[model samples]
Target: MQAGAGQTPARRSRRRSPVPFLIAWIVIIMMGTAGAWLYSEHMKQQITAQIEAQTARQIAAMENNYEQRIKELDAGYSSQIAKLQSEVDSLNELLTFTKDNASNKTDNSNKLYTQLSQVQKQLDELKRKLDMLK
Candidate 1:
């Protein structure tokens, strides 16, 4: 009985405190939380960068498509204007010739003059449209 009492006192003096282990665990948990927060922020930045890059690419493609369509329409308008101009010129020449030579053909000369006026009006309208487009 006296020997057991002495062994109990020695064991109590050699025992470790739970306070140091609790502090170590707390430090470890804090470090893990901080690391997770930093990783989350880094991932968010990367995702933002990727989204912005995709948007820029989409914008560029749209701009290119619009530019090409504009060029094609411009070419179509140019050809139409050239053809109309040539028609007006030819009609003018024919109308002048008819006026000078057709002394007894009043009906034919009047028809030719009306047609020339109509063609000239159309040419002027087309020119106005082309200028507005520019």
Candidate 2:
């Protein structure tokens, strides 16, 4: 006998089951997946908001540009109309003066009448164009 060997061991080393460790790992992975999904959703929402804001700004800019263009066109048309009316009035005064003088020259009267008719036709055409613009 070697110096009082133990008759029996009080306890033995035991192997632990792997099931708890496996369960813990699975839980951690699931939590990570959920977090990733939430982050992706948040990013998507932010992107959508930015896009909508940009679109709204573009639309507002376009509307403003069109309004400015329309205003410019209106001013131009007004000046043109006033100029045409003045020309017509001046022509009328000239015709009246010529008639009152009555030189009795048939050729000159005929030429003046033809020019007046042509001017009238041009005025009519301009009126039609103005109406179309309106």
Candidate 3:
């Protein structure tokens, strides 16, 4: 060993034991692995939350579409009901007119028969027209 400035030749310094260093290195590596695992877990949670939010939005949109379709169907039914009611009212009026004329029949039974036959023919024609509409 070489002497430093006017000092006697120095003995070699003792080498540090490797056992403590190895233990420290193992501890550091374990800590790094644990940190990585925790970070991955946190990221997984975030991804799950995002997917759930997207699904909820999709479900809400589908529900809104269903409600809109129901409204359209209800409107169509209401229109059909109104048309049918009008047709029924028209038939009622025709029946009332026929009844009023029949009540004013003359004393001769032949005239009454003729008037009844004509009303029956008119009703048959109206029914045929209604059937065609259907």
Candidate 4:
């Protein structure tokens, strides 16, 4: 190498400081961490909402089944009660009919007994008069 006429020895190029590189690396790490955290939070929110929606659907289905069962039970009970009521009404009618028939029979028997007593008295009086004549 030859030295120039007006210039001294060539100066070495200045090296870049490591401080700016370190700062840039730190900023990149921070941004990556923040982005990851945001993504994780968003995923958590989505999962929570999905679970809540599924729970709501299950609850609604259970309620519908319960209501249907209740309606079926009510219908069965109503039918059974109606049958019992009909049976009770029929028994009452039978009891009334039997009572009226017994009353009629009792009245007829009393009249027959009174007629037999009158006939017996008349026969006894005839027998006494025939004995006195003899």
Best by lDDT: 1
Q: Residue 79's C-alpha lDDT in candidate 2? A: 72
Q: Write the per-residue lDDT of candidate 4 for residues 103-130, one digit (tens) a residue.
A: 6675554554454445445445544543
TM-score, predicted candidate 2 vs. hidden true structure:
0.61
List the candidate numbers ranked by lDDT, top first: 1, 2, 3, 4
Error of 1 at 53 (Å): 2.1
Model 3 C-alpha lDDT per residue in residues 1-134, reported as the tens digit of each score:
66777666555567999999999999999999999999999999999999999999999999999878767766665565556556556655655665677755445445445555565565556555544444
lDDT of 1 by residue, 22-132 (tens): 999999999999999999999999999999999999999999998888788778878887887888788888877887897788898788788878877887887787677
Off by over 4 Å in 3: 1-18, 92-134
lDDT of prediction 4:
0.68
Worst 10 residues of 4 by lDDT: 125-134
Better-scoring candidate (TM-score), 2 or 3: 2
After superposing all C-alphas onto the true structure, candidate 1 shows an RMSD in angstroms of 4.0
**Candidate 2 lDDT, 1-134, residue by residue in tens:** 33335544555457999999999999999999999999999999999999999999999999999878767776776676677667767777777777778878666667767777776776676667656656
Name the regions of candidate 4 deviating beyond 4 angstroms. 1-16, 95-134
lDDT of each: 0.84, 0.78, 0.70, 0.68
The TM-score leader among the candidates is 1
Per-candidate TM equals 0.64, 0.61, 0.53, 0.56
| Clash count, candidate 3 | 0
